[model samples]
Target: METRRVIFFLFDQVHLMDLAGAVTVFYESGCCGQPYELRYVSPYPQAGVSCGLSFTNLEPLEAVTITSSDILMLAGMDLSKWNHADDMKWIPWVQAAAATGATVCSVCTAAFALAVAGLLDGRPCTTHWGYTAALQEHFPKAQVLENRLFVQSDNIFTSAGISTGIDLALYLVEQDHGPAFAYKVAKDMVIYIRRDGAATQQSVHLQHRQHINHQVHQVQDYIAHHLPEKITIDDLAALVFSSSRNLTRLFKTVTGITIGQYIKELRQEKALQLLKEGHKLSWVAQSSGISSQGELRLLAKQAGRGRLA
Candidate 1:
């Protein structure tokens, strides 16, 4: 297998986690047999990181020749301390890499750098939620999405905040090596295999789990674990030792979704996953607890329409 090159473009006062998080993901992914040649480049001889540490002996960005298979990541830095005259030198290099069909990505405020390069103009992108307003104000042409973990437009990708960089890197891994390999990498890293870029900042499972109701949580856990089996409201209510009617009311109040809707959403999500693993439609429906392939197909069609809307 030809090794894919991943290069990090570092600058002064760069967020340490934004840079290190992605590096760790890529490194751990390599342990699973994904061949990646990681490199660090900067305009300066050494780059100061936000955590009072520095990356030294970095290759000069101008000296490197980016290729089509290369992934060039721009690390987030302190926007207030940025020097436009000095930093503007890197913009042309970014454009050059993009022109070569290399995948360009930004972590957090690094989207600002891409915007300066005119690469993000008229593209759907996002930055840290705190900076989303500023990003929109500066780049009026860019559609800055709020509360998104990441956004991908063509070969350009942008992610929210510091830790979401790992999510984006794992997403890239999945895009390259399939979901099974990406899941293995995520498992090795002890992190969830995050949803797609279009997903909300928090997943449905995580979003609905912030309550202190242990009994309701028990029912949620049962549903998640027993998706392949036939589950009913009575079964969930029995898990919590409550009447079905009361359980339904409590579940809706806590999760904001009725029990039936939650189950349907879970089944649809599971069906999508099984399909991604190359399973047949009928098998996906069976494994995801959908009654038949026809139901799965209708759900998929509805999902497609939602995306288009």
Candidate 2:
């Protein structure tokens, strides 16, 4: 495993959860075969944080060097005074860091800082739900997304509110490692892996888990990981140790969707993820169990997402 430095950009009166939640995710990944050097650097040497405690033992912002493999995380902060006397220093540093290919990320109100550095311009980014309009009004160039749990446009990532920072951090871990490892991290943290996007855009890993059926959960997990293979109702029934008739009826009752529909949606979700990552259409079809390009397009179109690719 490669060692990656995950640096947190600290400031005075910063939201503690915004910083700590993501820090916990990266720090805990070390136990799971992912080596990460977690560092904290601040514009000031030390300052008071939102949790009524001071953030101490911090290095100055100019002390460390930035690299392409480094991850810079800016947590939520008081944005009203963002432009006050700090212009000549950190903004240019942030711009240069992004130019150097470091992945720039923000949680909640820190989107304003990224916007000030002009990183979010023409990129789809999100902030706390209440501040989306203000961000768009102030920085008209940024494509501000309102209802996203988080948005990832290339290397720049932004999330909504404090808790979603953990979601984004888990996502970052997933990108570096893999879904299975990320899921392990989430399981260890005792939190759900609420994958990227809000509402209807939720990842397949989380979307169908609203029910309390263990058998259905197992079936869904199997279907998701085996998207490229053919799965029959008999396979699921045997896996759950039930008759085909009983399993089919119970699956629909528990998940509110039939087994076939669940499999199809899982494949569609895989196809959409592949498409978003710029894979070729044929590969998307094959990897997502869509049979062919024509079938993939037809499924997406029927789902009310025309020209999905």
Candidate 3:
């Protein structure tokens, strides 16, 4: 078997979780035990990567002249301070690397780097939810999705914040090894194998309401306002002056998901964002109105896994 070279591009202020999660997932899957080579490369050779807490092994990017690699991964970086000079400096190199037919990926806010390099233009991609609006504003040609855990179009993959990188890695593990192997790896890791973008975010309540009829909107709004309450579809429909059947169809059409699915997704997403913000897992579930811890785990799993390539 030919070994696949996976290069992780790192920089200062890179999110340590994003890089380490991916490395851990791939390493634990036994891919590194066989035909898989993983290495860390940086813009400056020998400069240690200060990811949150500790230094990470990093090689210089300029040290290698070859553009060919099985995969190139751009780890999370704080792009708020990124400059045009930085873009001009690496565009040619990035473009050349992509021309080699290697799969390219970005984790969390690292999608900003890919977009600045013009690699995400017209591609279906995602980034950390906090940056989704800015990413769309910066790269209008790119279709930016805020609620997705990851988006895979062509050979380029972009995932949401932090731990979502592990999901993306596990997704790749599934593609290369098969579902059974992927399941085993996920099981061993005590992680979920299936995740989806049907998950929610802050603007989801208003977003869904705006797309549907006024009655449907009222019901959705009511649901959002009363999430902790035991509100049913029938109850929601009555509040909207409609039958449950009509409400269900409208909900599905407007959001491309059933009412229950939408509610669950919204609750899950909020729970996750809260958890990432350092809210205790127990508190996140309680505050988000999700009753079950197992349910939260399933949602986290759903929010983590993304497209497989």
The count of backbone overlaps in candidate 2 is: 0
- Per-residue lDDT tens digits of candidate 3, residues 1-309? 776677887755667788888887777777434346777776644333344454545666665453454678888876644444645555676677787877788999889888888889999899999989999998999999878888888888899978888878877776787644654566556655445445332145434432425565566656666666676888888887789898898878866778987787667667777765656667776678898967777666655633211
Model 1 residue 42 lDDT?
A: 89
RMSD of each: 6.7, 4.6, 16.6
Best candidate according to TM-score:
2
What lDDT does candidate 1 reach at residue 43? 83
How well does each candidate superpose onto the true structure, as a TM-score?
Answer: 0.72, 0.78, 0.59
Q: Which of the two, 1 or 2, has more TM-score?
A: 2
lDDT of 2 by residue, 8-113 (tens): 9976778889999999999889987787999898887776677688888898878888899999999888775454486656787888888888988999899988
Decide which is better by TM-score, 2 or 3.
2
lDDT of 1 by residue, 164-196 (tens): 899899888977997557756776777765554
- Window of ten residues with lowest summed lDDT in model 1: 300-309
lDDT agreement of model 2 with the native: 0.83
Per-residue lDDT for 145 in model 2?
Answer: 85
